[model samples]
Target: MKRLNIGLKEVQGVYDGPEGKLWELIMGEQIHIGGFMESMVMAKKAGIKEGQKVLDLCSALGGGLRFLVKNFKVQGFGLDGTKTMFDEAKKRAQAEKVADKIEFKLGNVLDIPWSEGTFDVVWGEDAWCYVTDKDKLVQGAAKVLKKGGTLAFSDWIEGPAGLTEAEAERVNKFMKFPYMESGKGYEAIIKKHGLTLKSSEDLGPHFASCIDLYIRMLSEQLTFDALRIIGDNMEMFKGMGGEMAFMADLARKGKFSRGRFIAVK
Candidate 1:
């Protein structure tokens, strides 16, 4: 797939502004598909143990970090490029009394600020879609992991059937994604970085259902709340809805989807 010109600056604009809030309104604090349940599954599959250090790349709002800290008793460090999200994640972690367990840093994931072999697990959620150079991102993740460490993540990805160039362009533009990687692309990157690919599951059907659920929430339940978040711009709301619907259509066709991956260093 052709990459878009979009990068960290474009992603920061979305998360720092009302568009970010709109996503929170629909996806809740986690802001990813399958939310808590998905996080739990990933943690279990990765064999995350109590007191193990974890780095969450693109850790928007630190929801995934907090979840791990509270549930799995892991020490968490979050790195995100967007200041608004970085600050809010810290605040929320403090408010939830997990501040002591997690630290948030505002920086590019492509150049991770942490030292090599610093973490027992490297984690991400759906947020990695916003990253432009996934090879660099995965390389960074692998570099930060201790020997025998796990890299566990779920991401929005190009599906099995793939997207036409036009379809990919529209979806990437609306989502501010530079590009979506295929499951195989991720597996290759993991192996290229000296990590062993353990598992990769295509979650297209579940992702489509999540999109449908979000559409229903925006159109039926949270219409006014979403409008308020966007400063009550009906036109903008409708436009966003149209784009989301288009994404939903593609997701159903297996052109756009999500993937859950687990690899070991």
Candidate 2:
């Protein structure tokens, strides 16, 4: 999480390395907060059920889609920004035997390759925070959903009062987020997209706990493995620990937040 001179390209390089694998190890296959617990909560709140269609925008490795398909009997497609991620996701689908239930594609989230009104749901995880054009992403999701479908996602966001500019810059550079919105801020965007808001709540407390847990896992239990993952770069590891600690404190204080939203199309 250190803001290493690693810009976007170099950041991508890290993901192609042990850093990305470390994230998967701590966060499970659902590399966002709360894993399947979080996914189940959102699916239930959105009234997702068997036979519904879904389009998972920015769906890394098809984990969330597989979770829904296996649990709710829904079928879906996952769209991600990277083919490397999709390639791994495809393998996961086949290995998990969800290959028949989900498909993975590589494309831009802001400009999906699918036709309009193609899905019953448009879903994302924490990945959307990476997009700079948040409105365009929202519009694309809205455009792709059927009239009676749902739009559901959970994202890393700013809290109700928002982040200080300096804090925002530091967090963005470390987390690779272009910008983050608050629960209130994202609700306004959903309304603008003409989706009926079912629920828009700050899930910051849950994420705070998750971050704290990961810190504990790395610092307390998995130190050796984690050290190997980063090639034993003690300075980088220390920087990441400090950055994560800052994020955890912000989440606990309601400055950095996670926003969960469900909307009717």
Output the number of the TM-score-best candidate: 1
TM-score of each: 0.98, 0.94
Model 2 ranges with Cα > 4 A deviation: 1-11
Q: lDDT tens string, model 2, 1-265?
A: 1222433354455456687778887888887898988899989988888999899988877889999999999988998876567788999999988899887887778789889998988988887777767788899899989998899999998887578888888998888776777788789899999999999888878889989999999899988888888899999889999999999998898899898999988
What stretches of model 1 exceed 4 Å from their correct place? Answer: none
Q: Per-residue lDDT for 1-265 in model 1, tens only? A: 7899998999999999998998898888998999999999999999999999999998999999999998999999999999999999999999999999998999999999999999999999998889988999999999999999999999999999899999999999999999999998898999999999999999999999999999999999999999998889999999998999999999999989999999999
RMSD of each: 0.8, 2.7
